[model samples]
Target: MSNFTYRKDHIPKGTACNRRPGFAMKPTTITIHNTANEKSSAANERAWLTNPSNKVQASYHIVIDEREAIECIPLNENAWHAGDGSGSTSGNRTSIGIEICESGNYTKTIDNAVMLVAQMLMERGWGVDRLRRHWDWSGKICPRLMYDGGTWSKWYAFKAAVQGRLNELKKEGVASVSDKVTVKAYGKQIKDGKLIDGTVYVPLRAVAEARGDQVSWDNNTKTATIYK
Candidate 1:
């Protein structure tokens, strides 16, 4: 199970007298935005979208805060997030929008958004190259913290963090690698080893068992013990 939490409070779908028809979207990119309203919380964003009295036609797929995330719209459906109109180039029609809440610690909020974006990319089999700032599709200065200054260092840093997290996730699923090297124990060949950075590494468990030795680990001491 994911450590992240999602609150599903979807915006009204389908065409109504006052609302636009819900259209299917194949998200090729993940669009990022900052609420701009520092006074608003993630809950506030969700509530505003759900409130019928609020005439704002804007909606997004998710709203992230320092503590949690809230799903405001379905990923497969279009949401009125990007300033672009209803067209092929519109971000709403081709991307998933994530709004970062600015209520709490700004750095922590950005960290939460990075994790959510990384998780989404992993699930969709997409790469960090698919990430985009709100300004990418439109000229609006959204996610001001990332794009306000002439230098885009903050935005670049955020993308780097997301990429790093994705790499970590991918490494977790990789079990082992085979390389050309020799491994020996007690003048007997136990198993082949791999040379990495000029250092030879053998499969510890395989070599230990092949030598008729039992291996035990001490979690507290972070050490491994081998006994005959």
Candidate 2:
């Protein structure tokens, strides 16, 4: 999934920000946001959300910095990040919120968020069309870096970056060899094949059969003959 490090120091479930129980989220979209506090890191933001004295009533699924991503809330649970209130808005019930840390290098922060979103999309079988900015849910310019300057070109560029990362993951295939190798003959998929040392080795009989060719095994010659 892009080999990025993920920290799972989740905020306490009893916190005021995430006190709702039995509320689950079926993530249909990925919401992008900016922490806005440039001096705070991802860990700092997570701590702030969990602090009893801080009653911000806000929490996000993940906070991404330039170096790593820290998951502050469970993806299956709702986080009050969309600012759409307690309504049944898509952002509150059907979307995963990711806040990009404003500290450190701006480009690196965005790149990290892009990779995280791309990986999530690939795992969930989602397309770039499912990506959304925080402003889409409410009139708030939440992801200020992306929605700032009154120009939408940055948002489009972010989507493009996510799409590019997704394409790369598809081409690279899964991490396991079994998922990375695919064999096809004459436009038909064949299962008797494996990836070995970056090369795909397929059974002769399987390939021949997939191509509608007859395969005969010669015991004496210790060979297989294909009749096309």
Candidate 3:
């Protein structure tokens, strides 16, 4: 209900691409990926980024390793990250992609990554239900052991994760969920009347009844209505 401060700086910058002339690309499906390494160091991950012929010429906007983070691409560009469904973003450009740099027999570093992604989603106006993963679109084992084993699709799982992150963000004081309000209370509610300007007009009798107060007014004397 109140205003919130969303820092654009909260998101990172994107990689420059000569492949396209604009950053208006959008995706319909999200893709999940595992960086296949445990070292979360940016330099370590950037080792593969410097190459143009790596075939994996795509760029990631964010990389999470432990508590560390890196901004590899800006949000406006079409990251060449995903393999199959990435052809045209209009159908999938809105999708978010995440690559956690821990893979192959490594422990799950997904906790932080998941939380961050959830917060990012909430901030982006994308509800938790829309959150998805890379494996949802492609057949890659990508997320691998960290991958979903449930009957729900990866997108659903991502949504559930977003819900969890919503809770977490609420707990952290970084987000708020409710926006209901009341201007008057009577008859167990504001059913007697509504708010007019900053003042709420209610039937005096109804209010008295709501508060267990009886009302009686002397017509001739024009006396006050008294009910309690």
Residue lDDT tens for model 2, 151-172: 8678899999999988998997
Question: Each model's C-alpha lDDT?
Answer: 0.76, 0.78, 0.52
Which candidate tops lDDT? 2
Maximum-TM-score candidate: 2
Clashing pairs in 2: none
TM-score for all predictions? 0.70, 0.73, 0.54
CA lDDT, candidate 1, residue 121 = 80
Candidate 1 weakest lDDT stretch, 10 residues = 12-21
Q: For model 1, how does the per-residue alpha-carbon lDDT over 118-195 read when each residue is reduced to its tens digit?
A: 777876677989998888888788778887375778889899999987887677753221235777775678456774
Q: How do all the candidates rank in terms of TM-score, highest first?
A: 2, 1, 3
lDDT of 3 by residue, 1-228 (tens): 112221111222332343222356443444556776665444456545654554544555556655454545445445555555445543235554566776332333455566666666554455555644555555566665455564436545545765777776666767322123343445376454643211355677766777777899898998867655
Instruction: Give the TM-score comparing model 1 with the true structure, all chains together.
Output: 0.70
* lDDT ranking, high to low: 2, 1, 3
Clashes of each: 0, 0, 24
Q: Which residue ranges in model 1 land beyond 4 Å of their true spot?
A: 1-4, 14-20, 174-228
Could you tell me the C-alpha RMSD of candidate 2 in Å?
10.9
